[model samples]
Target: MKTASIAHRVVDFLRRWPPFQYFDDDELFSLVSAGRVVFHERDELVFMQGRQRKPYVYVIQQGAVRLEEQSEDGVDQLRDVRGEGDLLGIGRYLGFGEHVYTARTETDVILYALPAEAFWETVKRHARASRFLATYFSVAILPPALEMREERSEELRLGRRPVDWMSRPVEQPSRPLTCLPDTAARDVARLLAERDAAAAVVIDGQGAPRGVVTPRTLSDEVASGRQPPDTPAQALMRPVCAVAAPGLEAGDYLTRMLDQQTEHLVLTANGRLDGPFAGVITRRDLTRVEGAAPLALIEDMARAPRISELAALRVQAEGVLAAGLTDPDATRWLAPMAGAFNAAVLRRVVMLVEGALADQGLASPNLDHCWVFFGSAARNELFTRHDLDCGLIYDDPDPGHARGARAYFLELGRRVSAALAACGFVTSAKAISAGHPSACRSVGEWEVAFADWIHQPIESCVYRATSRFDLRPVHGDCRLVERLERHIHGEEDRNPRFVPLLLEDSMANLPPLTFFRGLVVDDEGGYREVLDLLRATLQPVVDIARALALDSGRQAPTTLDRLLVLQPEDDESSLLIEETAAAFRNALYHRARTGLTTGTDGSRVDPAKLTRLEQNLLKSGFRTVLRLMEYTGRRYGLTPRR
Candidate 1:
């Protein structure tokens, strides 16, 4: 074929794939014009494993190539198959320097050979193209952590910091609302209402902030008839837990608010209790400057009066997650915000359900009872498609009221589950919800159940125990959950067999990857070719992190946080942990983006549609997950199932 005809054909083929699809006509023509075509017969060796790579990368114009690994027995194992539009010999182009797998022609092949340096230079000139290339290369050959660090360093050098978008001074209004300790509670409430303020700060004689009085305090005291209208403000005030010095970055103060779970913070000159109070920075002020602030959404969730209101806020919260997907650091804030919203909604449902029960003359359960969330909800890593996985842990009632209490709580659970469903949460399919009889157990019953699961280690029980192990108190008495956590830790320590069983259970689902180190897609039923990002990518990391954290006696709920707190035994272990953490973050970013764009939970990823960067990150993440699984098996002395 003539030179122009061959170049035109190559350009046509390259345009069908991305980031080439993003290239304009002139760019496409130029890219292909600099490339040359080569033909290989069936069974021909394109590249040999362990040999230095050629200076050019190949793009298949026609036919197929097989990537193979030489086994210890000298037999070749099929790793991956590449066809039209697939880029071959990418390992060396990605700086691997040598081929890990030998590539041979599966059929007579027509390939376009592009100069590696020229192709890289072209990719670097386009931002999207560079990102796609970088992503692909990182997954195929580089460690995700190294890629992330390099990308972040480049961003910093270019003066594009994620914090820059959130950093601003907290706006302070002149003559902020203030009250004296001796002020009547009714008067303080009236003043707050008149000023349209969520809270008011109480100052001492020296103008140092003593406490903050919020609507919650007024509702708990005056409106509930626990205190009279003449009660002093000091009696209704809560000590301010978060205080910051003036002139500090607003982002710093916002971090404090999120950490403390407070809506208001007092600003003092020296950030000391005795220092003169400067002003107050309400959650509202911080949110005004940085919309989608997690602390602000949490405050909004808490104050929502109706289920409908919470449902609306849930959509907004998802929008925040969508925005956060572009920046990996934002994932840290996303989970906590989603958790707070889930907790608020659950609390509201419980309250409504209790009121309905009272109207029907059913007595309330003991105040010592707690509502415990399990699985993703407990980890505070909720996605929009997540189901309700929770149960009730109550103090045993008096002998005469025992039967009645059980009946009452079961009814309450059913009502609460229905209420949550009405607000968009689905009931747990595994019957893990509070409405299930087995889940609505007394504290002693729960202890017995845990002991049974620990001692038995049966398959069915192990599956149930996986969710139960990640317990968190979403509402009611938190002490119950605290006690349960201690019991779980103590049981694990005492039972030598528990850790191995847990490790075995965690290794049940390995990350889906084919022999050629390519992603395995769902070929089952309706979801053909779809990647189960949640199960194949996220779950393995979550399970491994959970087992390690539990074994180390670390109590962090979320997977990423647990991984962060774990003290790896050596430098190699530490590197593995770090790489796995980075991979986890990247997976979260991909899932969030997919969920946002598709209006679903972001659990399913279509590998074909993923950008080069996303694919690379995912591949690197899967690799890390596999390594972690192998480490677990070796550490526990468990043999592979083959």
Candidate 2:
């Protein structure tokens, strides 16, 4: 009788929430039948700063709750508030250890809770409703309300109208600067110093740029202390590297400067540099505004309330990154910037889960643990759609708070994954999310799992190993992941024999090329080029690097970094791998830039629009992918499967 009454109250509470709002009387009744209700008095703590907790998410019914965060300096500050219709206690259900923040009731509070097992089973049967509910939570449950309404507006706009964030902004110093060829060196230097600038365009009688006198020239000339200060600037001026443009995106302009490592860029109103310097872009300019919209959003996301917001911003940033790939320098700078965004999102996810767990009274105040991202997500080497591969680890073998800690992480994964999906990641068909029981194992359990994968060495294991090797830990008590590194290196160091096997696996997936000399897309015929590019080329680099790193017991953080660290510099094989990776990245940008410009899918490209030179660039890219595969294949004495 008591259980029935509790369930009734729970259903009544759920009826007020959006994702669950449409539930009919019977459906609501069915859902709360498996729920538990709890009561809290004023100033009562439902969860503490650290305690392991059971599996159940909570809903606020009659009173309000406050979520607060414990900072690095040991200060606690209120981060969020929850009241009627709000989903509460999700942290407890997610099961990440050590709450990111603590929670307290502002007044007498009545909450309805549903066990994790019950929630999962029910959500599985109600996939559509669950998705809706997940989306609802992602939108509604951010911490401190995270000032994310602006970014959210972007998402809404994106839903109804495609908005280009990478497009050049309206406000810029587009006015041309001019100087005379006969101007004295001291006079030109005067203009340069007055503007706090580096260069000026020396104009002729026709108002055309005749020669350029830049800070480089002035600095060198003045430092020599030989030429007269009043010497004509024409004697020191040199031809400038100018771009003929029909206007360019800021991304385009930035790419040019970074590629040449030059400070100044000259723009022409027409399509050639000789006409005149319409405007200039200095490294200072890029440095000042480098917090581009996506990066700004990423910075915003570091303090963002929920993973959903982070995910959305991350996807948008990925788009921005893709657009910048139109030039090589942009591609290189964008990679680490992408990593920054990825790391920020990941760090915030951990913080949020930590807060939630603490608020729920599930975290163990003293137990040590760390969280980490795995696979591409870990490396921040993610795509627009990818799985939320993450894990947790523990230091103490028999930490008494094991069960509650594990439970917290499981819940964290559940909520975060749901949020991640709402943000933009494609749903994993295999259900390999950290929320899954098998994937959300403790660090020791992870060791066992990794060991099994390594020792088995079968088809399934090979596939899993490739994914595992790419794993990077982004957040949490990072020692957990460090332990993972030690474990991998320790095992490899002992055996040294698996290196060949891994290299062989690297070559297993051959480069994609049709027998008829056209691109070989997949059986589905969707973005076959992307698949070929990644599998045939990119994966091989990732694989060969992992194998070589393992063989030498070296910890190379990135694929590029791994290539850079190889023993014999300038070796053909190493050079081939590095060059191929670069080419593949360039090809990816080619596709990305074209897509951004034409509103096409970013994954595929129509080769026809490319100029002959562009087409050649792409072919060079594909060949590089092939070459990368071949180099890895040769390294291990294996032939590609294809």
Candidate 3:
């Protein structure tokens, strides 16, 4: 064939798929000219598992290929089937030198093999084309990407040379000197000197961090004779510079300090400044880590000057999470750390939204308000596939001002929500976000809303409460959230019908188990015959923990923490609690591992992928979920509704 004719045929095929479709005609033709056609017979091996990869990527022009993995018993199990337009040899393109899965032609096939170098050159030249390919790669070829990552994790775990910028285990430094906001500055200084600390955290009555007093502030206030030593610490301290959460690496604190240009960062138990104070990280801690920190991405997101920069920083945050998945302890920390990063992103989005609203000549909301997060984000159990479930709660607006104030907050919600989506948070399908008017309400409105839901106790109301009751303040004035929390706990305590309805709702989804079939799979959903680990396993535990915690007048955010705080009524219950806790941990570990490996929320598991021990542990976990449901039923004098 003539060179031009051959290139024309290749371009014709390339234009039919994404990424190439994003390229201009001239770019497409140029991209195709560097490629050549290759042919494979039916059943011929295109690439072998464990073989070093070639420096070329293949796009099928005709026919199909099967990706398979060989088991220890020497049996080939089909992993995926790819047809025309599907890219192959991506393992090599992604820098995984050895093919993890063997690709074999399912029929006589024609493929265009493009050199990796040329493809990357094109990707570099076309920004939109690169984005198109990235979206395609994340959605379609993520499994292989995950496999490559897991291989790197294994290398690290085996004590191979460490990746640059090693993450040191997060430590809880000795408790910093603390005082009430009303404490005299002289007393604060004495305590700081007595504790041998450079700063003191000034907290409110509830132990929520309000501000910080550093040596410089002390010197400026007292030593300069600008104010009497009797001045309250609240008047002298600066707003808390930044808050670090547990499990954050030393590098994370360092990055926060560098980004804020502050010498000190407070450590909070759950990453919320309003949560319990744990410790502090100072400038001295930065010396422990020798390279650029991944947490720098979060800092970058916070300081991002534009929406585009914020969006790009989020991608970097995801990369950080992906890299951290290799370390087991780091993996444990990934969800919470991701939550902290997300909170910072959301705050930036809010600031931008407020600024945009101001530019539009819209008046700011005329009430104190808060941004509340629900579901996994609220519980600090966020993972890759989680979406935004948030709402707005403002102080009661004057009746005459209600309409305008509501409209302003609603628009703010919509703008911030859209920004969050751009930053990689999936929008909730249920419309249970700040963007929804029903979810954006005043504090009094929320109180009345909870009361109405409790009094009604309808199925839908209970269902909504199951998620809503897990709310936590993510940004804005958190006092509104504290008020909302007080209202929920009070309603739970006063209403006799609320706990039973909640119990019934929690028990509605029973864990799957059948003696003959073993672990039951969801047959009706997209995950047909695959175990719905999130629904059947983790959620039941989560639901039961929420119910029990509420019943005990406690509001622990996470399932594990809630389970730990429960006071079992009997030895049997205690044993179940301990066993159930262990099982829950196992299930969580498995989900995290699977999600990290597959680049999705690890909510589903194929039994075949689990070893015998893991399978047994999962079975036990489900059984414990079932038992907890029954216990709730009996404790509440409730019967399963037909």
On TM-score, the candidate that comes out on top is: 1
lDDT of 2 by residue, 1-642 (tens): 687776766676676564366456775676677666789999998787776655666777788787766778997755455567665555533335555557889889987776656555554444333533343222123222122221221111112222233345423465455688778888888887877765687777765666668877887886578678887877888776555363566555554443333456765556465564566665555556443354345557776777667776776766666544535434445554555565566567667766877788765535466655565555445434445566556555456767766776677777666655666656556435767776677778777776666666673465664666656655556677788778877766665557777777676655433211123432122223233335544556667777777777777666666776777444665556556556656544553454345544344554434432343344445455556666666666777664
Residue 136, candidate 3: how far off, in angstroms? Answer: 40
Model 1, 1-642: lDDT tens per residue? 788887887888898775677577887787677778899999999899989988788888788787788988998856556677677776655458989899999789999898877676666556556555555443324423232323342211211224444546766757678899999998998998998887888999999999999988999989999999888888888997568887766666665675456877888889988888888887778767765367767777777777788777777766665554445555565566567667767877788778778999887755489998888788877656457588999987887878888898888988888778777775545647788888898887898888788877784477666878888887778788888888888988898788777778777765654212233522111123667877766887888788888888977978888988988788778788888877787777667666667766678877767544455566667667777888878889864232
TM-score of each: 0.81, 0.50, 0.60
Residue 245, model 2: Cα distance from true site in angstroms? 36
Q: What is the TM-score of candidate 2?
A: 0.50
Instruction: After the best TM-score superposition of candidate 3, give how far the Cα of residue 396 lies from its true spot, in angstroms.
Output: 0.9
- Deviation (Å) of 390 in candidate 1: 1.5
**All models: lDDT?**
0.73, 0.58, 0.70
